[model samples]
Target: MAQREVIVGSRVGLHARPAALFVKTVSAQPVKMTIRKGDGAPVDARSILRVLALGAKHGDTVVLEADGEGAEEALDAVATVVAEDHDDPA
Candidate 1:
């Protein structure tokens, strides 16, 4: 399994559009990925509802996990999205 930690960068955190984008990215990965707020239990990364339920706010640390092939790439991809400021205009 592969795991990584990233800080949520969206000004409003992983909600609404940001959550949707994050879930879409996770779903596109070759491997399934799970995410959790801090040390909380992992939830399906592909589910917008589960992700929204996380209530991950800006600057909150989240852990992502995945297994099987391409796990590293999958983690990296989602990590990038997690660390991006979706609310940014730039």
Candidate 2:
């Protein structure tokens, strides 16, 4: 498995829009991914509900993990999205 730890950058955290964007990124990846807030149990990163339910607040550290081919790249891509400040003007 590959892993990437990132700090949430959106002002509102992983709420509606941010969570949806993160899930979209995860969905695009070839490998299955899971995310965990701090030491909490991991949840499917592709699930918007699971991600929003994590209640990941701004500045919170979250760990993304994936196994299989291209896991490292997949984690990196998803991590980038998770760490971006989606609330800001794009």
Highest lDDT, which number? Answer: 1
For model 1, the run of ten residues with the poorest summed lDDT? 81-90
Best by TM-score: 1
- Please provide, for model 2 over 9-78, each residue's C-alpha lDDT reduced to its tens digit, 9 standing for 90 to 100: 9899999888988988899999999999999999999889899999999999999999999999888888
Task: Tell me the whole-model lDDT of each prediction, alpha carbons only.
Answer: 0.94, 0.92
Evaluated at residue 62, the lDDT of candidate 1 is 96
| Residue 14 local lDDT, model 1 | 97
Off by over 4 Å in 1: none
